[model samples]
Target: MIRTATPADVPAVHALIRELAAYEKAPQEARATEEQLREALFGERPAVFAHVAVDDVSGETVGFALWFLNFSTWRGVHGIYLEDLYVSPGARGGGHGRALLTGLAWICVERGYERLEWSVLDWNEPAIGFYEALGARPQDGWTGYRLTDGALAALGGSGH
Candidate 1:
């Protein structure tokens, strides 16, 4: 079953995040704290939204997907930007990942969004194939970039 996540789901969500980080070989970079997650996901003003997939009989969380809205200048519509999608190793091959993606796609269509986008590491061939099988194509011409911490500070100071 897939449903919107609540504050009560934070612990399980964090556990899955850690599992995903470890699988991606960067466990140490999963620095999110309970307080931060709570504030961002359940506080008065939400920064993002999440959906959890639960086992029907066991009632255990098997996977989750977190996302936020983004505007596409070219399409002139707001679409979902998937931040993370993690499924426990034990739950692999169970269709949970496809279920999560389907749910998100339904949300996009229901809301009239023009697109949904996410990035997969180049080395994660399994994930790349899974996404391709779902009819998603890689944005061949675009490269993602980010500025963090000191870079952000410098940019802020530069006022440009």
Candidate 2:
């Protein structure tokens, strides 16, 4: 069954994040700490949300999906932007991934959001195909960019 993640699920979610990073070929890049996750999920002003898939019989966490609300300037509505989605390697092929996405889609429809979206690495053909099969079209000709940590600090200090 799928359910909203509470603060206590931070450890499991963090481990899933690491697994996702490893699947993306960058295990060392997962820098999220359990404390950080707790703060993010249970802070005075929470910045993100998560859902988990649990086994009915074993009561084991089988998957997790982390996302946040993003504003769409064109649509003028708040939409869910999925950041990380991972299903335990042994728990895959059991509809967990699609079930997680369906849950998020239900949230969007219930809230009148215009879209539900996420990014997949260019090399992950399997994932790209999976999303396509779900009727999600890729937005081509769009380039992604990021400025983090030191670069972000430097730019902020530049006082534009």
Candidate 3:
């Protein structure tokens, strides 16, 4: 079952994130601490939200989905931007991943959101197939961009 992650689940969620990082071939990039996750999801004015899938019999956490709301000025509505979704290696080929996604889609429908979207690495053919099977289409002709850490600070300083 998929449910909203509470503060008690921070450690498990962080572990899932690290697992995902390793699967993506960037084990060193998984730097988020459990405290950081707690603050982000449970702090005053939360910046992001997360959901996790639990084993029915074992009650063990098997997957997680982290996301934030995004607004599309052109659509004049808010949508969900999925930051990450990870299913444990041992839990692959099960319905946990789809269940998590279906839960998010339900949230969007309940909230009147225009879309639920995310990006996948071009080399991740399995993931691409999974999403496509769910009837999700890629936004072609668009290139993704990022500005983080030092680059983000440098850009803001230049604006000064």
Per-residue lDDT of candidate 3, residues 1-160 (tens digit): 8899999999999988888998999999888899988999999999899999999889999999999999999999999999999899788788999999999999999999989999999999999999999999999999999998999999999976
Stretches > 4 Å off in candidate 2: none
Query: 70-115, model 2: which lDDT tens digit per residue?
Result: 9999989999999988888888888888999999999999999988
Candidate 3: regions farther than 4 A off: none
Task: Select the stronger candidate by lDDT from 1 and 3.
Answer: 3
CA error at residue 135 for candidate 2, angstroms? 0.7
Q: What's model 2's lDDT at 140?
A: 88
Tens-digit per-residue lDDT, 1-39, candidate 1? 889999999999988988999999999989998788878
The whole-model lDDT of each prediction reads 0.92, 0.90, 0.94
* lDDT measured at residue 96 in model 2 versus the true structure, 0 to 100: 87
- Compare the candidates by TM-score and give the number of the best one: 3
Question: Which candidate number maximizes lDDT?
Answer: 3
For each candidate in turn, the TM-score is 0.95, 0.95, 0.96
* Consecutive 10-residue window with the lowest summed lDDT within model 1: 86-95
Model 1 residue 66 lDDT score = 94
